[model samples]
Target: METRYNLKSPAVKRLMKEAAELKDPTDHYHAQPLEDNLFEWHFTVRGPPDSDFDGGVYHGRIVLPPEYPMKPPSIILLTANGRFEVGKKICLSISGHHPETWQPSWSIRTALLAIIGFMPTKGEGAIGSLDYTPEERRALAKKSQDFYCEGCGSLMKEALLPVTSGSASSQADKEAKELARQISFKAEVNSSRKSVAEPADLSGFNHLPSSPEHQQESTTLAFQDTTPNEVSENQTNSASSSQEQHNQPASNNTSMSPRQRRAQQRRVPTSTNFNQVQQPRVNTNHMGSNALILLLVLALAALIFRRIYLANEYIFEL
Candidate 1:
């Protein structure tokens, strides 16, 4: 059994570099690759302050492919955020479900920003997306801080510190620009090598050029005040409710009323499956045309036979 993947590969190295450089510029979100696997990462996202997700810290998992930066990752929320289904792959233009839309230059930072912003918007009939009410989202958001993943070995709030002092986008924007610059440089190098028909040796290619000062800043986030006591107390009951709702299979919905079931079904987008519609139309047309031709042939044969019989009878009488 082969258990090793090329962790030293160009794609893997780039991801590792990005992971090290992942600083919470906005302090609203914190993410890092797992200790055991560089391809697997977990992140905590802070809800927008004015939206229903305000004051909420949501936890989720990101599974990057071995060919990452080219292929998008699969993202699943572990926390029971009302906007998305727990432990399910979210359907977003940036997620693995839509690789065609994924740009090789896009990093984890861009995806995180998209997720935070998309949380409060309509579900758009995407998988793992939901249209819960604002009040429901607020309730879930309040409880999200308490939810923990054993894999990360830390509570959502304990691991990621909230930004209390500085401006939100200052640090984040700087990190993003630096990442984009690195990506562009790498792309240019790859294109140049390809044009000359040279075998590219990217083992020594360290585009971002890791800095000691940048490494120190990763651990410098300040913690904000915790959620209210009331929010924590209600979490005990809401925890079970959220878990039950999250774990419950979609197929076991006999308990749901007709209206409720229809509502749930409607959340799933109808596929543009041409086979379901076009096959039936073609079959009906083909059958109708064939039957009409057969009927016409039979009628013509009968008329000819009747005329021949009448002519024979008249000849016999003469």
Candidate 2:
């Protein structure tokens, strides 16, 4: 094992430490790395108690990735266990199928415990899962003891130690059972949340018509429901009222007193009246421009006259 993998590598060191810790077999489960390959391990776990798989000793393969502890390992069953397919990677929270949930703190022992815990639960059509009947599973459990592995060179019956009472293995079994229960509960909660969220997400679009023709008809009905004649009549009435307002000033001017006429002229100007008022400002600007030009021309003429007078005086002096 030392020559097969780099001793300095973290995965190698971790695996070697784990191998030392699990050197002895327990009644519940036992696993060891292959002599030729440190990354590959064979394991045997007793079926969870009081389930269809009770009394079954199932063999399986564990293929650890190069980045073990940081990544999850793959699990494959070899024995004819009714709960999981043979020679296929089983999907579990601790398996490679769910690396997002796998923690580096979890070890091979935790995985074995989880697997034992999972056997009694419903498969729910998950990959590598089987929904075999209880009778079939019981029969398979009886036959699993006779199953042998060519690679491990051990019978399933002899893979683990005999069950003992009040031992460390029993505690491990309890822990496994609890872990499996928690995992199953979490999965059910997540699935329920997804199912509830799906309808809410699609709720907004439900009121919308599904077919194009129905949508077009609804749009048309919306427009038909609005009274265009009333809107046009309102516009027409507003225009006539405004016309009356404009005519009222001129018509009432003859009857108005001097004070009333002055007050009317001081009122805020309408758009047309405002434009008329701005017209004279443009003429005033033009007048200012003409005045400026005249001042400039006068200044230039005065300068020219002064220059001529100086020239004449110079000629007189000469």
Candidate 3:
């Protein structure tokens, strides 16, 4: 009865809390802009150290579902041109396209960290992976520094970075930075490096079923797609075929008797109750003939099956 957008989703909540607590290389490399609308976020990631993108800052977008951890968020590489296709939706387990493997506990920070750690690996044949010459990747990665996503019109300004004064790092930032380091880097990122799987404990988040009303509404919507006229037409066709069969005569030959042919010429309804169900007259000879043919076909099939069984048995004995 009561429906409201779930802004304070558990996954987003935990992610925000953890993100706020983080500082250091992980935080420095990635910045999750926008805290109000948890469903949409833009992140800047520093390239994997010592790689071609080393010290490079990259920008990307993370679009979360209202269901939060219930569904995976889609990740798009906005700044990097290497290995990943720019602007196109990259297939990832953590994206909404695949819910089975996503985890509710996976924070944006975790996804960002894993994404950076994965860069040194080769781009060979991985989902959401792309391959560009090292030169191109590095160039884009360098440009990613100071890159802004203000031009993406659909995104909210509040969800984007606000102008700040003074040094970006503050005093309390130092302690959070130290804590961020203590968290051990679990290689939950797949070999593909484009997705972040939920921690083991959070894998079942999507298993929760929708509300009863949702199911009912979905069924109703599905039913509406089948028009009443279409169904009636199908039913009428079935009835007509049934009547044709009832009126048919018992002839196995290529030709029909005049009376048999006359009955066949009349279109009949398919109802079982020939009189009350509104069908044309039944032809006894045609019914008998059809029954006889069915019986003969069954007999032939049985004989063939029996012969096959005997042959197989003989071969085994040999």
Which scores higher on lDDT, 1 or 3? 1
The digit string of per-residue lDDT tens for model 2 on 72-153 reads: 9999999998899999999987899877577898888888889998999888888899999999999999999999999979
lDDT values for all models: 0.69, 0.80, 0.55
Q: Tell me the deviation in Å of residue 132 in model 3.
A: 0.7
Clashes of each: 1, 0, 16
Worst 10 residues of 1 by lDDT: 217-226
Model 1, CA-based lDDT? 0.69
Per-residue lDDT of candidate 1, residues 78-146 (tens digit):
988788899999987678987756788788877776677677667868899988888999999889888
Model number with the top lDDT:
2
- After superposition, the stretches of candidate 2 with alpha carbons farther than 4 Å from their true spots are 1-3, 167-169, 185-318
TM-score of 3: 0.44
Instruction: List the candidates' TM-scores in order.
Output: 0.52, 0.59, 0.44
Q: Give Cα distance to truth, residue 301, candidate 3, Å.
A: 16
- For model 3, residues 1-318, the per-residue Cα lDDT tens digits are 343334466765655665576433333444453545545676666565457775466667887776766667788877655856677666544455456556777666656664564565565675678877788878876665556576342222222243223355332233333323432222233323424332321333233338886456544444455688875785686677666676555434457654453344344422323334234334568887677567656666765685576567657756
- Candidate 1 or 2, higher lDDT? 2
